[model samples]
Target: MYSIDETYKNIEAEFKPRSKWDQGVKETALAVLDSLDMPETVLPDHFGSRRALLLNGADNWREYSYGGCALVYNVDIAARFFTPSEMRRYMADGHDASMAFRGEPLLDLQARALSQAERVISRYAREH
Candidate 1:
């Protein structure tokens, strides 16, 4: 039942680091969140209605994504989730497709993430 702000605070504290780079990145993320006009409460359906979560990335993104998914799952907000590169090849084809025609690595990653998010949302809508 934590508000999004409270959840973010908890995450910030959990990610507090001794390394300068990590600390800086965490601070930047929190600052961006703080500047946004967000809802005071976390919506019940914030993670989607059908309980499927798709998270992308390999390194830091994977860690943070898994952590958030675990937190939501702990609170009964997520029933199932998968980190990128964990599933079968067939299941990963869509993500691969997102990178097919992209030139830049960053743009390809962004497109892949967007594609995955849209897929998750659409699948959730259909299943629920």
Candidate 2:
């Protein structure tokens, strides 16, 4: 999903496995979804969780910063629901609500994500 030039270098780093705690947190989150029979294939993957991780771990975010905000787009995930251009058009390519979640523990974030997912899914089921 990345261009084959300078982005390739960044891709190499992005593919690095999550550290131990991240791995554990992600697994537990996924397991929670599974326990509820909410398969990822059929459910939403919000940009919220991904955004927090990326920006919190961002190296020299200062390089991208302007007016204390930076344009941070995760094309790999956004492409699932929006094109890069569409994302920028809709402000999806910029910092968003998820920024408020910075410094939160992974488990706390996961619990909220799962709760939100469950609420949305349940609402959808009722309306449909």
Candidate 3:
């Protein structure tokens, strides 16, 4: 697994601005993404799968995006296994948040992504 520092360095070095005005946004976004784990493969067009993988304890999955931005934790285990409230708080105060008011949106974005992933997993489990 890539340590947070290593991930951040890679993200920082690899992240490029799509446009001149996006430089700072991309940098700050990558910084946030680097702090968490989200897979590059399953990421929906605008979502991060790595965060879900990490949260769900998916082994060998250690990548992230600006926020993994949105997430949906299993109600049965979320409170017991992770700190959703604390996560929300941090999201409100984290680097991306400091950079732009838009950062908080990641919370909702990732939640939806997680929900979709769970549905897919559930369907697969039922089939096999």
Highest TM-score scorer: 1
Specify the poorest-scoring 10-residue window by lDDT in model 2: 63-72
So what's the TM-score on candidate 1? 0.31
Q: Is candidate 1 or candidate 2 better by TM-score?
A: 1
lDDT of 3 by residue, 1-128 (tens): 34434444444565454642244343434434443454342323212453454344432222122233322232221222225554354355444432222343343333433444333332222212
Give the top-scoring candidate (lDDT).
3
Q: Residue 39 error for model 1, in Å?
A: 4.9
lDDT of 3: 0.36
Q: Model 2: per-residue lDDT, tens digit, 1-128?
A: 22112222332333243443334333333333343332333332344543332233333223212212222333322332333564465454465633422454223344443344333333332212
Superposed model 1: Cα runs more than 4 Å off: 43-128
- Kindly list the per-residue Cα lDDT of model 1 for residues 46-83, writing each as its tens digit: 45421222232223333433444222221121112222
User: Which residue pairs show collisions in model 1?
Assistant: none
Candidate 2 stretches greater than 4 Å from native: 1-33, 36-101
TM-score of 3: 0.26
